[model samples]
Target: MDINCTTYELEVLHKIADAADALKLPCYLIGGFVRDKIIGRPTKDADIVCIGDGIELAHKVASSFSPKPYVAFFKNFGTAQIKIPTPSSEGSDTLNHLQLFEIEFVGARKESYQQTSRKPMVAPGNLTDDQNRRDFTINALAISLNKHDFGQLLDPFNGLKAIQKGIIETPLAPDETFSDDPLRMMRAIRFAAQLNFTITPATFEAIKANANRIKIVSQERITDELNKIVLSTKPSIGFDLLSKSGLLQLIFPQMMLLHGAENVEGMGHKDNFYHTLQVLDNIAAHTNDLWLRWAAILHDIAKPQTKKFEQGHGFTFHGHEVVGARMVPKIFSRLKLPLNEKMRLVQKLVELHLRPISLTKENITDSAVRRLLFDAGENIDDLMLLCHADITSKNKHKVKKYQQNFELVRMRMAEVEAKDHLRNWQPPITGELIMATFNLTPSREVGIIKDAIREAILDGIIPNHFDAAHTFMLQKAAMLNLYPVQQP
Candidate 1:
């Protein structure tokens, strides 16, 4: 009640307070729910830190609702959670489809840690003890839900003032805090990026000093935090902080390799690291697709390895797109990211990012556009977006010129796609049909004919039709000293 809540939210809190009163327990809304509400950020999940048995309070609260909410409790962790369904909208016939309000209940506890693992040795404690264990001051703010101080705000660590100033600071000494749970370091940066806040100088310095301790955390947890950073409105902030803190080298060394620019013969290239971040920001402004943003991040990942300075050209990352595509799987594997279709989408975008831009510079050809459409397939638009974002030239006129060229490429694609339908194009002539016509098994001749037919269609030599491809197939077959057998 200390923070503004919707009518339904207040009702749920009143129920929780009623339940706690009946049980003779002190309960408070704590953690992100309190912080987000105070900062005017929309939040659904709330954490209830109770002075007594949290699981019992959860069950007691669940019984108050009409359709009893299920109390899922983990005895080992002494925590419980319930998701209360939203009341149906007025005059609606169907069931409530809105997201349930998720509340996690846990007894106030103090924690001690070992050098080997972040798994804490826990024991029951008071609210002050629990607040002392929070990773950041902003997250430690709580709202009392007891009868005596139901709407009272508790900012024991001056969390409200920290929130007001938009700063991230740990309640305890940051080194002790981070060493106890190294994941908190990642969380600190993530909050900074998410809230557009600054990490207190001392806290940030502690993060740098204990950056190596991040190795003790699991890859999955690290990647999870990294993904949160990437999904934030301005992810470059987080990555920059990570790089400055030296955490990037430990957690993702491949990206760290992109940190510097090199100079040769009085010619230097733009720093690929900052260039990548600019591209990421550019793409983020256009789309919230995480994979597309990831594509922007990795579009130039192989630049460091492929960097070359020709006699005339200052710097050239020749074939970097191909090399970057090949590196995607390895990066994905190391980051503990999903190696499924999502990763493939990012890989495809990274590989094809240069294709659309190349088209903009040259005399646009239908065949070239068709090939790009075919290669990029369903992801053509996304690939185009990534390419546009990749143009990080600081010259305003140069950027404008490149964008105009990109517009031309997009127009060409539209024309070619409408006429040829080459997006996600499939070859009209199949290897099986070629083999059957030539009366041969799966041999080199079949593959040769199939490739030729596909190239012919992409080149606009033959219409994308089975009959034209069939005739073209026969003509090419004869050139190879092969003839189709007579059919019945």
Candidate 2:
């Protein structure tokens, strides 16, 4: 089968073939470039494998370009790379306007791994050996770049059929493949999630059998794969596979805790695990933000921890949001995720996930809306999206009622925001100003006055204007039997 190639790509391939010919070496375009081309996916990198010295061939190819691209060669790995700038459609000279495409050259080689480590011993080998070491069949497909057969596909493993069938199967025996490099297990799930494909039954069972081998892999690598899965169009597919394959229990026991629901006195709650997945998928439908999806994944994470059954009440997870928010940092640290603003965003969302739901249930008030705006600040919209996705009841009427109430709350929020202008709002009075006005040191009285002013504004007893806050501050200070040292 022939793969479609753009004019520029064909020119680059010809140059590579010319270089290999000059060196009397055989070369082919292999792996993701070939696979993605067949599936009509946009790819930015090309992998070229040659039977002779890949670094030498890469240097030769680089010299053929007008402005020779720099060649970065790794002698230990027998690989080299060249990044060439693709002229913009408008042919702008601005550096930012140009797109760079990476071409990686590697020599065909075989690998053997010891039982204790994922790192494999490498040696120069033939094309068949290189294909044999591939993780999956679809990824093993190759296209010859030789002048004799410019775009000929080499598919001894029937990888093209697997691509057509939408299947993810190891090129070799699944057990041997996974046992050699356990990280491939995560790659398998990632591919399944990305392509929305199915893992063959035999391949899946092999993953389950070798799931424990994942321990040998580093946390950074594991979390990298996990993030890719989380960013897929529908992430729940990957998580469900992880759970069924027993990898979730090993990698993330906290999520596993959300799996089962219990009964007490003929009362039971919906399975939090499935509910979390539904919320994730719902948020996925609305936004592609990775942190927001993470918030959905963790919004109800503490339900299992805080679950309680009372005699009259069915189930109560009164403080799950608070608990879950507190759990975010530790989970992120354990998973080797970023500890900066991204973690803070997820934590803040988890803490406030229930605020909009509570507003929907209660009488909509300006005070409540103002408080939510102040607390959520810039993330109010995201918080609302989370709350909307949180409405996952089986009863259609109940869901509709909640949705209608949410709309009412949203309308009220807009009115209050337009009138009060309280998004990311702070009180007009400052503690330092209060202290300065009262001729006092940093003390409890200053804190009390600041809190009073803030509460008065949010409670609608005073306007957010400086004059109203100043008057309220003076009134509270008088009540405290204090007088301003200076008059304005």
Candidate 3:
């Protein structure tokens, strides 16, 4: 009952209360807004559940705001949203005092799902009926915003006990709850990962039993949950649960493929699946960058496909990088991820993951360092984080050695970056300049010359500047027997 409300939130609730009173309707502040408030996490989004028309409540609520926030009403779904600025950053030199907050209002409803589809048949219902349909107990908590019992907590399912126990359990029977919508099973695990909570034995078993029903859910919805799991603090925990509960194979068979190790000739490779998770957890510690964390999860994805046992030399994955790079596009497309630069960055990291580690074992040349800087450019730091995370050996000494070597690599990068400035670094000689210099337009020779210029810069063969690149270009052009065009 002791849920603290900020001054801004109090203002929001007062407006909402006024709106509900004007229409003579019952409404409650529910779900995430209530859950987050009790947990003391910062939140600017509110979910208001009204017994009557949610769209009309949203309109009335918007009218109550000072500037009359826009109400985006959806009649078919009985949902509406109003956005307002709510400041959300901390520092001396802060930006945006007022941040954009979203207030979504939906009618209290009960849902029944058919066996074949994930969509539920929804209709207006009483508060208890609405609470019964909640996916988990913790999410079922609601606060009254009506005049008589304003800010009163209503948790019939003892959601507070579940939150205190750090447990994820369904409000209703686990079997029926998950059977109605298998996506709830995923939501249970996702909540466990996000909240770092435990799934009770009954709930866990229900998920395992109903795991196969995940196929009925759309890939986008499934991947959205999968991504949330991947982005958690300890993603491996959720993924391991997904594998154990037999849900992963149905949803993400590719990741499931990384589960085991094969031994041949008294030698073997580490289970890539566990290794990938360790890398993900490690990257999570250093950054909250979601895409960078994704790169860590996928860094060694092609090891299984490229695995082969070589005599005496043991196991080798010769082209896993290339194979993994090739697999990225199809995987992204199938998984409903953006096929833009984010995908490309992941691909580049997978291909280059082993390079810095490989460098650590050798004399560690300047040319190699330059190439890495040039290839990685701005992403060099993230690549290093992934490389550091990739050191998941059981040997403490091996881990220490890898960490030490990474520090050296980072120091070397500082040196190289200072000298060459290759990050977002472009070659001084443009392809167009090369074309004009050699009196050619769009030929294979121009491409060859361009590659050579880039290579020379990456190889530390010359200073990364126009004059040096020009001199190298002329020499390379001479070797190709292409004469320079005279100035007109």
Candidate 4:
């Protein structure tokens, strides 16, 4: 292999080779590390497989370092890890400032999964068996770590050729490989998306045939891969693969549901599925926050549910925000995503996604901006980003016009926010003050007056402060026939 290993990596691998020679064992540096090194991709963690005791090999490797680096071993899985920290992280001058890498040692093993479960029965195997078990040909390549050939490339499956061609193909027959572990199907598509590589014809066919097997995988694992796809430079690539392979329908049926558009009297709505992907890609360019991109993906998710065909209008999705907001929890629950503030943030964005667009339509008021600021609070920036990303029309004039009007809406928001202090702004008057000055208990009158006070504050009838709120409360109180009695 002409793949140049960095000085640190070479030192570690040569150490492993020496240790294996001393103990009379066989081992190889395998899988992702080799693939990444060949492709000039940086990798901090390198995987090594040993025919003998991997734990012993790891301990010896750790001891070989000058300071005797610590070895963390997993006895059950027969694996161990040793961290090689450069001066950058540990601030130790003993090592070069080049970079740090972790070397993981594991016993060469073969696995057999049960028909209904992904968990595998495992036993020690040779290098060939280990290579055959890898998910993809590109990942199946290994480098010798034995005495005879310390850095020899062992490509039993022509992985180098596949890598050169920018192709993702399984080592074995696609169907059998997918049948053994269906998650490989998702992995293949994810790899294709991440590397911008093409899926081979047979591999793509296998994904379609094995789509149902994805149901057996856990939602957490599925979401983990989905999140990786979402975080890719161009996420739309993965969504297209998911849709084509049919796994998208099984894993996230909601997004897949956004697939088609129907024509009513030669008037048709855009294909929301493709539009959502475009919006996701657009949002991705500006921010790398995963949840914010999620908002973009789901901003118009409820259009299908709220679709209405009017005689004059083509299609109106009235109150899709409300429906979309309700759908967030169910989608999050099904995907095993966090049900915490992240979900609520996505829900809020879905609920108010159309509000800014409404501002661009007709005569928008300062009060509208105030209400938007109050509702969006700390999330105003992200909400605006999602709204800006939502402008995905192919019409250049319409796009330019909406952008200009959107900028106006932004200016109005800034003007109103400066004067009113209404981004997450609160009502100046408290219910406690209302009860204290009036000597009243918690009652319908308290709620009624509280609601009125909030309205007055948001409507700009009163400045958002204590004195103005207190003075307004008195007049409103007189109308309700409530007055403080005279003191002795």
Best by TM-score: 1
Model 1, runs deviating above 4 Å:
87-95, 436-439, 480-488
- Model 4 residue 245 CA deviation (Å) reads 1.0
Q: Rate the local accuracy (lDDT) of all candidates.
A: 0.91, 0.91, 0.87, 0.88
Residue 480, candidate 2: Cα error in Å is 3.4
Q: Alpha-carbon error at 383 in model 1, in Å? A: 0.4
lDDT-superior candidate, 2 or 3: 2
The residue pairs that clash in candidate 4, if any, are none
Model 2, total clashes: 0
Report how far residue 59 has shifted in candidate 3, in Å.
1.7
Report the C-alpha lDDT of model 1 over 1-488, residue by residue, as the tens digit.
55777777787888899999999999999899989998999897999999999999999999998789889999999999999866476344333647688999999999999998999999999999999999999999989999998978998999999999999999999999999999999999999989999999999999999999998999999999999999899999999999999999999888988988789899999988999999998998999998888999999999999988998778899999999999999999999889999999999998888899998878999989988999999989899888888888889999999999989898888988999998877778777788888899998888888889999998999999988998999999999999989999
The total number of steric clashes, by the backbone 3 Å criterion, in model 3 comes to: 3
> After TM-score superposition, what is the CA distance of residue 185 in candidate 3 from its true location, in Å?
1.4
Per-residue C-alpha lDDT of model 3 across residues 89-157, encoded as one tens digit per residue: 432223243677789999899899888987899988988888899899999998888999987899999
TM-score of each: 0.96, 0.95, 0.94, 0.92
- Pairwise lDDT winner, candidates 1 and 4: 1
**Distance from true position, residue 259, model 2, in Å?**
0.6
On TM-score, the stronger of 1 and 3 is: 1
